[model samples]
Target: MGLVGAATGPSDGRRARVRIADVALHAITRRAARRIDHIIGDSTQARRATELLKELADLLL
Candidate 1:
């Protein structure tokens, strides 16, 4: 059978947005250790996510 397209909903939009934000956050967090201000130009959500990720990393490390 061929692939079928699924209907999109609000949750789908939210998930897509979250995924994009996560990618940005990860990139910033990975690079920030070497360049602290590199992620300053990103969106607020990305920055907030990065902060949370950093906290989690610190806890785990």
Candidate 2:
């Protein structure tokens, strides 16, 4: 397994307090960051990208 897979693997005899909502939000944020980075690189679609990013931020928050 890779780094993320190993880190998130079955417990190692230790209690780790992790919230489901927090985990979901973290995954969503990572995905959004990658998409926004790609969109921001294209100058011609900037206006639409900005609007979409705002909408995504509103949903995430």
lDDT of each: 0.63, 0.64
| Distance from true location, Cα of 30 in model 1, Å | 21
lDDT of 2 at 11: 65
TM-score of each: 0.32, 0.37
lDDT of 1 at 13: 52
Candidate 1 CA-lDDT value: 0.63
- lDDT (0-100) at residue 23 of candidate 2? 62
Candidate 1 C-alpha lDDT tens digits along 7-61 = 3357665443223355566777787768545546668867798899999999999
Q: Which residue pairs clash in candidate 1? A: none
lDDT of 1 at 29: 76
Q: Residue by residue across 1-61, what tens digits does model 2's lDDT show?
A: 2213223336664644444465667887798777455547777688787789899999999
Best by lDDT: 2
